[model samples]
Target: MTDIPLEHVHVAPDDGADSEPAPAVFVLHGRGADEEDLLPVAAELPDELHVVSLRAPDPLQGGYTWYELDLSAGGLESSQPDAEDFRRSLDLIVESVDAAVDAYGLDADRIGLLGFSQGAITSLSLLLEEPDRYAWVVALHGYLAASYASLDPDGIESKPVFVGAGAGDRVIPESRTTAAVDRLEDVGADVASGSFPGGHGIGPQELEAVVEFVAARAV
Candidate 1:
């Protein structure tokens, strides 16, 4: 993955305000989806915001995946993200955020994150590592990875986070989803969670809630 360069798609406000940096949102797609997969969602954000979607480094099943899922022991076990690769990607993203703030003239303190599935997992991991970095986060159809258990909510500043799951999702079981939300809330994160009626995907209702969540962060 190191040999391959990181790729991304950037969408600036269409209101002819290209020269000034504005608020920003980082969009992350699910496993097997490319950077552009979430552009439509990005477009739904405030027009004064700059949006950027990033592609995962590793390739899988002809698409891209953030890491290798280790489901060997009957049920889902863990992920096999190359430690070095994961570290490098993390560093690059932190740098990217800083670069976006400068290059796009974004409000440095108002950056937010939106992600689905594996993308959501990555976003949450990043936030746990640096709680003060993002103003808010919207995670869809995903849970907090077990590896992040070492993160304590008491050690970090409070921040808003939205986690939406599918009530019928077997992929990420309800127990795991509930546990994730509980853990985040226990750690002092202002967590807002809900369940859509469907399964492992976001529907129109979830999108509406996500937009409202992000909008409220602007207040």
Candidate 2:
């Protein structure tokens, strides 16, 4: 079996115990950020969830990246991931999550995902690849990759997905975010999307909305 190489930070549920398994939300940060970058956001999440924030395996700009980005189709610095690296990273995450279930005694059926920017791209991609695997998802300021654009969605049910993007974001661009939302909805995923005013970062309203979104569904 391959090794799970991603580093992580796990926050136990507030009213949880070792004997009783709790639901979990695995968090993935944006490019150039680490496991701890999403701690504050994790703190604001529902207390019933055991939050596990993972560091991307590859390093970039003194931080971490899920995989090397492919800019060959260059137009405004497209953030499409290098296909092979992306696959490897996805395997790492899957292994790491399976291990977390064994190690932390988390509820496998209630696994959720949250991410921003490049991390969002990964999260959304994972959701598309395995619709029934995740209970819910939140992808911020990230778009769908062209790789999994044609997945068979007949197996997907009413999976809840919350998508947030800054109207002024230029890095990944708002249009890319909208495209992601459209794709998710097209695949029969229940998507809640909002375009806020900002640039490449989450605003107060976005945070509040995300917190509420998770709370309503936390197991």
TM-score per model over all chains:
0.87, 0.95
Q: Which stretches of candidate 2 lie over 4 Å from their true place?
A: 1-4
Cα error, residue 1 of model 1, in Å, equals 21
Q: Provide the lDDT at 103 for model 2.
A: 83
Top-lDDT structure, candidate number: 2
> What is the per-residue lDDT of model 1 for residues 54-114, given as tens digits with 9 covering 90 to 100?
7887787777877766555356523334456556667777777776676666787788888
Model 2 CA lDDT for position 31: 88
How accurate locally, in lDDT, is each candidate?
0.76, 0.87
Q: Candidate 1: where are CA atoms >4 Å away?
A: 1-5, 18-20, 77-85, 153-155
Find the candidate with the highest TM-score and give its number: 2
Candidate 2, residues 113-183, lDDT tens digits: the string is 99998889889888888777788999999998899777756546688999999989989898989988887
Which pairs of residues collide in model 1? 21-104, 21-105
Query: In terms of TM-score, how similar is model 2 to the real structure?
Result: 0.95
